[model samples]
Target: MDERQAINAGKAALITLAVICLGALGVLVWEYATTKEVTNTAAVAVLLVSGGLFWAFERMFGAEAPRSLLGRELPTGATAAERAERRRAYAVDALALAISGVVLGIGGFMLGDPDAFGSLGLPGGPVTGAVLGFVALFVISFSLSWLVGEADSRAVEKRLARLEAQV
Candidate 1:
């Protein structure tokens, strides 16, 4: 198959893997919450298998093709409404980041507080680790969104260039 087709196939495979991993993780979490014993082996195995599959696919198909999903695509000469829509995309992204940061911050605060879940009998080290983990999640999430937005802007510029060349 051509590179584009291969890349699409790889993306589909990765997406399927992600869904399966998430499902398995959800099951693990549910069992742990209900029974107090972590049934995480299956989830771990799924993650390992998916990671191997992704590595193999990347080796076979090469790097992924550049892609952008900024809500709506704009043409070479965008209308005023389209320009506004583009700005709205960034605004929506900022709103999402703000919301996520708040949620993560709350979680981190609750976990760090010994009184929040006193019955669980979590040790201080684990609580500290969990709090730090949430902080890392907040930072990583915002960084990823920023990187993706930058990539989308570059992709739009390239698309505009191609459209101008055709004129």
Candidate 2:
């Protein structure tokens, strides 16, 4: 296949794999909730839903997407080389997104802290803390995975472009 075709194929494969993983995750999450406590169910549900959402987002809006989708949004026009460069930048941007998720998680933990919330005049206690903790983990893990997948797609696209250029 050509450079663009190969990149698209890789993206499709990754999305398919993510969908399969989410299927298994759903089952496991259900079992975890039923076997454990009811309070823990929301955490698992959030984790699973967030993961699915992240994967779907990446599948729809990776390196290959913004080119076609955002071109109308920017009339400046982009050459093949510029598109390739954008792919690289998108890969780096994914990392920034992952870092943002981490930072948000840290802030969530602080805000959700029992003692900390008391000072804030909205203390909900451990249940609140645990729920927030689960949300943090879910958001962090899902965001990181989604970013990594997009970055991987960008790398694949860039590599394919280089190979095509060499040939």
Candidate 3:
């Protein structure tokens, strides 16, 4: 397909994925509200599907956009800087996803066992776990993002140097 057509297709696919995600989320919420019970199966399905969507999104539009998502190599058309930027964007997206997963996992655990935290003498129960999990997720995600960004920068610099030497 031509570039414009490919872009349009990608956009359509993204919208469809988003709608599917929303529908899944709605079902999850409805199930929880009606049952008044923590459903691990539904929650896990949502998380897994969401994570798959995130990965698909990154593969489709991040550093590999210039090439087909199924392609194994980076396209020659993308400059080092552009690739680096895309990599950084992917890192941020991944970090956000990690944080979300942590929160969701903790929330699920809390809902499944209300007294799990109370036995520890924590005043606010799951709130304390949520807070701690958030802090830990932030720290871990930030560190990982920084490392990925640094690696991307190094790769870009090396590519630029090689290009400069060839000229």
Candidate 4:
């Protein structure tokens, strides 16, 4: 892939990863705030540092071949609309990450506040629930990011199909 394409692909990957991390954060925050768990303070700190490391990887990763949802690498010479669409998608991915972050933050807060669950006092035990919820979200996001990356590949395939038909 060319430099521009590589950068774009990296941006997309980074944005997606960020979103997943944010989702995890949301759950952590909610759990902590509601439970008033002190251990969460350390966990959140660890998460923040881990996020920074991930960002660093985005800058250092190898060349990226932009792919579509279908997993086909995009053509080097995509049309204006196609390229724009990809960029737009990347922006959305970034926004998704931001939303996830906020959710996780809220989750953490909820987890921290023991009084927050007052009305809902119908809980058997939130300890296991919180752990399970966070883990599930992180795993789901991890898988989704892997599959969604195929979007780039799919776009590439579509472009190729268009070119082939024109031939």
Candidate 5:
């Protein structure tokens, strides 16, 4: 396929995957609460409903840039300082998102089976793979945001500095 077609396909696939994931996650919570496994038909119905809701949400709150769907990084502001600041901001955001995802995923996993992790002789070891997978998901989203066009880097830098000073 051509580059454009490939990108489009990739975007669609990613969105669908995310939607299905949401449904599966719902199933997990449901199963945990009820202690009953979901049947194939119920699972499929839940998946469809959840996916539709997610799609609707996306449509209602569309991205500012269409290129973002195709993994285009945003442009930074002009001047060296502005560019540096933008890069730093992106890196910080990406790292924070990735770390948060992994941490939360591991926490949830442990909550579900605390002894399972401790028994492994390595705390967090049992859930490490799943945690990393969650982090990867966050990283993908961050990477796509990073691909958007450059912003007013100087403004961003000043705002970040102010926020840092406030903390």
Candidate 6:
């Protein structure tokens, strides 16, 4: 087969594998939900092997392979305007994450206190766990945003340098 046909075949195989992996995961969840325990070692193995295979195939086929499989195009660097838009998007994501962190923190604090009305009947731990969770989530969200922005900026710089050198 030609290159396009080969790519299509590879994508189809990946999709099939993904479906199987998802099915395995669903089965594990179902088993856990029904029995309160997961005894399916085989299914877990399937998921682990599938993950390894997926990683290996992506390496073999190049980065675009999975993106194409997901019907997404590789981002071809970004302009200043696009970068600004991304920053706005990241800011929104950070805000959402912060709100979620606050909710989780309150929930954790309430859960840790036996006097709380919504206590889930578990052994209570320190309320500091809640504060830690909130802080961790806040830090992680901003760190991720910063890392992505930095990577995008570096990619743009490289592309610009290449273009300038060629001119």
lDDT of 5 by residue, 79-112 (tens): 7785565556566666766776666666866679
Q: Report how far residue 155 has shifted in candidate 3, in Å.
A: 11
Among all candidates shown, the one with the greatest TM-score: 6
Clashes of each: 0, 0, 0, 39, 14, 0
lDDT at 23 for candidate 2?
66
Question: Residue 120: error of model 5 in Å?
Answer: 17
| Model 3: how far residue 128 lies from native, Å | 11
> CA lDDT of each candidate?
0.59, 0.53, 0.60, 0.57, 0.57, 0.63
Q: Which stretches of candidate 3 lie over 4 Å from their true place?
A: 38-50, 64-135, 147-167
lDDT of 3 by residue, 136-164 (tens): 66667656655654554455455556658
Which residue runs does candidate 5 get wrong by more than 4 Å?
Answer: 1-76, 113-127, 134-138, 149-167
For residues 1-167, what per-residue lDDT tens digits would candidate 1 score against the true structure? Answer: 75478768878877887798788788888888999998578787887787888667655543332222444543322467744554555455555665565565557567675443223455674455445545555566546754654454555566557658978
| lDDT at residue 98 of model 5 (Cα atoms) | 72
Candidate 1 ranges with C-alpha deviation above 4 Å: 48-70, 73-92, 100-141, 148-167
lDDT of 4: 0.57
TM-score of each: 0.44, 0.34, 0.42, 0.30, 0.36, 0.52
Which has the better TM-score: candidate 3, or candidate 5?
A: 3
Pairs of residues clashing in candidate 6:
none
**Every candidate's CA RMSD:** 8.5, 10.7, 9.9, 13.3, 13.3, 7.2
Q: Between 1 and 2, whose TM-score is larger?
A: 1
TM-score of 4: 0.30
Per-residue alpha-carbon lDDT of candidate 6 for residues 13-87, written as tens digits (9 for 90 to 100)? 789889999999999999999999999999999999999898766444322411122244324346777556555
Using TM-score, rank the candidates from best to worst: 6, 1, 3, 5, 2, 4
What are the per-residue Cα lDDT tens digits for candidate 2 across 1-167? 76467568667766776676676667666776787634455555656676776566555434442322123221112467755565455445454555555555556657764343123333676445444555555566545544654465565466557668999
Give the distance in Å from residue 69's predicted Cα in candidate 1 to where it truly belongs.
8.2
